[model samples]
Target: MPYITGERKQGLLLPSSIEDYINPSDPVRAYDAFVDQVDITELGIQTEPNRVGAPEFDPRAMLKLLVYGYSYGVRSSRKLERATHHNLSFIWLTGGLQPDHKTIARFRRDNQAALSNILKACAHVCLKLGLVEGNTLFVDGTKVHANASMKNTWTEKRCLESLKDIDSRIARILSECEQADASEQGNPSLVKMRECLGKQGKLKEKIQGVLKDLQAGQKNATNTTDPESVRLRSNGRLGVGYNCQSVVDDKHGLIVHSDVVQASCDSNQFSLQIEKAQQALGKPCATACADAGYASTEDLKKSLDEGMDVIVPSARQVKDPSSRVKKEHFAYDAKDDCYRCPQGHLLRYIGDHKQTKSRIYAVGDPEQCRQCPLFRRCTNSDQGRRVERLFLEDVRERIEQRYLQADAQAVYRRRKLRVEHPFGHLKQNLGIRSFLLRGLAGVKAEAALAATAFNLVRITTILGPEAFVQRLAA
Candidate 1:
């Protein structure tokens, strides 16, 4: 069989207009049209030329480049810079203008506020399309590696030990200088001693700075490279990374809001993220769905107090196997202020659990516990089974009751699919498993860009590029 022949590069003929090469339904058109429609000036992108040295590139054009780069999964400044030179879509998006890598990087780094506006603009389009009216929003986070090395981590223990080592070296250096001045027999020279001492002094300052950060209580450990980042464990592997959070609307899996946090704990982020997500969506989320990781007293109480039904199970409930006896098996009797075990044993309230700030309840007699059938599976203690009810246990219990309903379960089940898809797209399909920027601010901006791209693509898919842009114009 003979292979088919194709036109030579030099002999190839194509449309004169670049727009003719891009399909009408291509997602880049939506990205372009969206940026063009956005009031880049109000979004903080400069519309006028600078009075200084060089005429500035249109912020609108630069905004297009960043959003399109994120949508295309070319996040690095250098990669995006290269894309402008040859990538047909990028060339079409920027109208054949190729900015350098430095310019591309500076544009992204400087326009985080405008990027946020772009995200809000995407959410507005979704709202107009009725994509965010589901009343259920899923909030979750994933660990994305920072532009920092895991080996650059500093702990309190390591910090203290390093300080001690530096102190000793400094002392030795001082002694060497004294000896050199006195005899010149053992020590090399005064200048060498001074240089060694200066080096040790700088090392001591760096370690002490790390020590100060650790003591500030933001994180127990610190990375010298990215100070705001913490040690995060994702997919059973630990690394220096930030917790990237997204509040996804359930209707079409649209990201209503996005943020990046320095803390690894998800429980503390619900109220903060929900407030922002609601702001972006322009309406409150009636029901919030998250996994067991977000079941905290502060969060659950706040959600209930706000009249928003939050569906979240405790980690224990989600992780315990069917064969294992879970905390849920021990039912709480609010009327009696006691707990009923699997064997119908009542564990009465004993005393206040001061350390845990909870009420402790236990079987009065250990001897009665010895007669139980599920004792071995329930507890290994000779003191019988004990349960600690938090001060806000009622809040968690209320959410727990709501979570058992079939409707709530149906909504809750959608959390993984609705929320994880953005991350899956960003990390797997878009090739952004790790962030291209460093520090919390830079990563947050990067996440916003990714989310904006996702929402823009989703809108195009639902409405088609031409249709969405037409709606934008309409």
Candidate 2:
């Protein structure tokens, strides 16, 4: 068999054009066209037709380069700068202009607000293209690693210990400096000791600041590298990262709203996400679905009050291992406002627990439970069994009832598919396991750019380059 061969130094007779490098059907062209049509001026990008001083690269070109680079999973600014020189797609997108990595990094960092607006712009485009229905939204959150390292994170106790160690080291160094100065004049050892002391002083200052924040109850743990980043449980392990929440429209998998939060859990974030999604869509979503993590009584009530049909599974109650009779086995008598146990015992309402906002109901007579034949299987406590119902127990029961319906169950089943798909693609394909930028603001910008890139790719996939270009033009 003959091996395929090519000329080592092939020369072109005619000068090759950058346009000739990529086909018109290439997605980069669509990306370029999309950027060209979108009003990035609202994103704080300059759009002057001409400049007087030293020539500046068009903001549109930079936007195109960044968006196109993110879509193809090239997130590092340095890598993108290199791509501008080597990659034909990047060359075509930037029109042969290669901005340095600092410029690229600055563009993303300084335009954090604008980057978020760009994400909204992309969502608006999706809506305009009739790709997003904005009727049903799926809310979910995933932990994305922050730029900080887990090793850099410190709890209050750890911070105090570290500060003590630094103080001891400084004391030892000061003692050494005193000895060096007394032993010899103009000794290098003295100079080295002073330098070490200065370095330690700065570190000590930083640690003390962190300690102050901890003492003030501003944060639970502090990351020296990224203060806004928090220690969160991710992928079954503790890591320094942010919890990224996203709301996806059911019409397409496009993310309508996204936010980066320090909260480790999603229970309190339900209402905020719904409000953001509704604001972004400029209309209310008829239904919302989330996993059990987002199910909280306050959030559930808020969702219902907002007129959205929420489909979130309630938290599973802890079953007593020794007893077979679960809370569900108890039957409530609405007429008498009491619960009847499986053994035919009435648990009358005693009073309300104000702290827990639950009404307590316990068996009126404990001696009757002591004499019952199923006492061991029913109540292990000497006070007999007790039941607590929340003030909003009726609302919870109504939500539970709705969750069991065929329609609600069907909608809930699509939650994982709609929500996880974007995260999976972002992590597995785009390599967004950890954020390139530091701080919450930077990470939020990075996330917005990533989401915008994902939406662009989806748009291009659904409507090929030509049609996508037409849509942008439209």
Candidate 3:
């Protein structure tokens, strides 16, 4: 049998493999092509120095490999390194070379400052691409895992008991060491005693350190590799995780301002996120939407003061009974400037003032409620029902007015579509159920990288690489 050759010509192309049709193009190759154009040495790369004092691989190339690896759910540096050998896209991207896992891990661990700068670069790209426009912005937070376990949380009592046990163990070890020193064959056992004593001493030092921490009012005793990470509650359950906040653009669901927080509640987060959105976009957005988590009187006041529009629902719980009362139930007395309840009793202002800015109209007619059948349904308090109104009742009134408006409802309906996609993709599709990094700073860097990767994915889907690169350059 004769072996047939495709071509007798020099520099001929090899035949395509069956695997070539599995994927139309190598995704890793596309990523590498994107990363090669940017020089990250000026920005600083995080990977370790080359082995045997050899020149390091291109930082941008390594970054492209890491990100593209992560995009396809390859999180472990070791796994990513393995993928480079066999994965065709990865092979093409890395030029058929594999950077070790340690190098990959060190790049992320060491280059905190550079990673932050890179995140900003991606954000700039989004801004230039018009993904982040200063219009409607959605604010929300999600929880990510901390480095510590829920079991490590030590209470004041637990700390005391744990320290006590350490002290007792140290005392026993010291006593044994002294006994060994006095024995007939002391020298041989002396080394063992000394070793035991040294270990005990180290334990004592650890105990003292913890005791001092408790004395200094350190409520959290989490001793993890990342010390800055705090325990935050998510879904009403306590866990060690970071609270990541994002202000997403309503236009393309791209995150504009992203931050990681240790704060458990969204109350204090609103003002900061709004401020970030303003800074990120270089202008306060025309309209900002947040749920009741960001709804506080002070936050609303601050947003309005900054010349930005806000759409936060009334906290519902803070509303006055006066608003709940039917209009027909209130009888106005023109002469005395008083109002009467439906029970035919005059309502007068009590000497006490309600803290809200609105006027307080109290109907303290003890006899009126005593005779009315609705008293039980109205007030459980013996002092009778007190109606306190806000000083700027009109502010809340206006908010309610907007809530009732058709346009506002429509905008609210758009909220889920605008903001939830990124988070859903991040948590479900991306497999980032919990954070692998710990501490506030580390987690912040991690969150930013995640958001950057997410934006890149979106930009890739919306416009091909050609358009995206042009936008980034522009």
Model 1 ranges with Cα > 4 A deviation: 1-23, 50-52, 168-197, 216-218, 322-326, 329-336, 340-346, 354-356, 365-375
- Candidate 1, residues 19-136, lDDT tens digits: the string is 7878877778888888887777777776656576787777788889998888878888899899999889899999888899999888888876676667777787778766678488
Q: Which stretches of candidate 2 lie over 4 Å from their true place?
A: 13-16, 46-52, 171-198, 317-325, 333-340, 344-356, 361-386
Candidate number that wins on lDDT, 1 or 2? 2
Model 2 TM-score? 0.89
Per lDDT, the best of the predicted structures is 2
TM-score of every model versus the real structure: 0.88, 0.89, 0.74
Tens-digit lDDT track for model 2 on 411-433? 98888888989999999998999
- Worst 10-residue lDDT window for candidate 2 reads 316-325
Supply candidate 2's per-residue lDDT for 344: 90
lDDT of each: 0.84, 0.86, 0.69
Q: Pick the candidate with the highest TM-score.
A: 2
